[model samples]
Target: MTVVFVLGVLLVFVAIALLAMALRPAEEAEGLNRSLAVIEAIADAPKELRKDLEKPFGERVLEPLQQRALAVGRRISGADAEERIRRSLDLAGNPAGWTVDRVTASKVIGAGIGFSFGLLAGMVLTDALTLRLVIAAVGVVLGFFAPNMYLYQLAYDRTNKLQQELPDAIDLMTISVESGLGFDAAVQQVAHNTQGPLADEFSRMLREMQLGMGRAEALRSLNERVNLDDLKAFVSAMVQADSFGIPIAQVLRVQSSEMRVKRRQRAEEKAQQVPVKITVPLIFFILPTLFIAVLGPAAITIMDNF
Candidate 1:
């Protein structure tokens, strides 16, 4: 027993050490530093390829682990999951540094860690072979899917935020256009003055347009990226307006008004559902507690008298 306990303790410490190492922040190099390195690489392109006599210790150690993780992920994850991950990343406004491959790697790493931890737990804490194997299997499955689940949640939350922020962004653009700014200028104004995913999308659309993409195409891409109904409606209207030579300001005003109405309707819908949402808690928790508190003393008195 003593030997087993000591081994378990050692295993736990090793796991903790590994976790700390993984969580430690990497050294951040500045943009200029990166540019200078790139310049040097370009300047050295003509030189013969010479192998580094001594690679950085961390790189030497980590590269093999990263490769293994990627391989493991490739084996476990399907192409469909990868495609879905890409869409989720887009929906999440492409949260900083999070990409499909990164999430896949994380899922692989998590599975490995979970499997190791489960094995150690089973050895230290259980005697039943079936239970131990089951625990380990469950751990592997959970770890493998956890990253995808988190990414889905991020996409869902960001979609909600985009919906919430859209009406205001439309209102801003409407105001800008009514004040005599051209449609493109109004879009630029919204991008510059507003802050949110919608504004960021506007800025990206403008950049796309500036890069020679048609305004209609850029607006379509914007709608595709967000996958929101209101934005899609606005995009469709704008594209139609441009195609038919309708006044841009009129389109803007109509979109702005409709978005406000939709926002209010959403609010009212949620408000109406509140009581329904509260019903389960009220019955299961509050009513039961109230009944116990009110009837407990009376029941005790009746029992005593009997």
Candidate 2:
């Protein structure tokens, strides 16, 4: 009976030792896991951070405000307005960071500013409520259309520049083609050498061609974007030449000569109009100054003598 009791106590001690051994690794593993989690959190602190906290006021506040303004403008504007704006943008060479949304938002902002200024001016200038409201309404109209007017002016100026540069660009292409480069290579040469909207357009057209668009289609696309009659003619000629398998060098030479003649004619026409353009200033300004100088002394002498 004493031996059995001793054996039973030893068995109990063994079981407790086994249980301790089993729990030791698990506790250590749990602590290691917690440490690893802490290390990972420390390592990923920057990546897990909110990026908006570091952004500028323009991006965080102004951008959202602009977006809301854009929504309002879009709701007020119809499809035709958007299309016209898009067309104008394309013609303006799509100025950097200027989008349809931005322009629309700008319209709203401009109108608000104009309205405020007009109200202030009216308060300072007039006491009548009707006249003040009229002035404010006029200001609103002007402000609302200001962006459109600016865009139209930009598009017109760009178109004029493109027109003026086209002849030179074509001449360069002609030279390149005459020097044994293929049509595409000649276009690339022009794009690389020239520095203007013409070169920019050529580069875009070349990209379109490279990206699996047919040459004729690319030319048509360029024509549609440019909104110039001369460019349209050039595009039509190129498309025809491509369709008929005509040698591009000959076409380019002919086009270059035509462009030069047209440019000379334009210069001469402007030269002829110089006299007409100067007439108003000559009569109203120069002649008036001369008359005033010449008559002033004589009139003063007569008045003094009489």
In order, the Cα lDDT scores of the candidates are 0.85, 0.90
Could you tell me how far off, in angstroms, the CA of residue 133 lies in candidate 2 after the best superposition?
1.1
Q: In order, how many clashes per candidate?
A: 0, 0
Tens digits of per-residue lDDT, candidate 2, 1-306, equal 999999999999999999987788877989999999987876677853746456878998998989888989999998797888888899888999888888999999888888998888889889999999988888888888898898889899998999899998998899999999999999999899879898999999999999999999999999988989889988999999999999999999899999999999999999999999999999999999999899999999999999
- What are the C-alpha RMSDs, in order, of all predicted structures? 15.1, 17.6
For candidate 2, report its TM-score: 0.81
Task: Give lDDT: candidate 1, residue 107.
Answer: 86
lDDT of 1 at 127: 94
Compute the lDDT for candidate 1.
0.85
TM-score for each of the candidates: 0.75, 0.81
lDDT of 1 by residue, 1-306 (tens): 999999999999999999987776555445657889987886676444434534677578766777778877878777698888888788878889887778888888888778888877888889999888888888888887887788778778877888998888888888888888899998899889988787888899999999999999998898888878887899999999999999999988889899999999999999999999999999999999999999999999999999
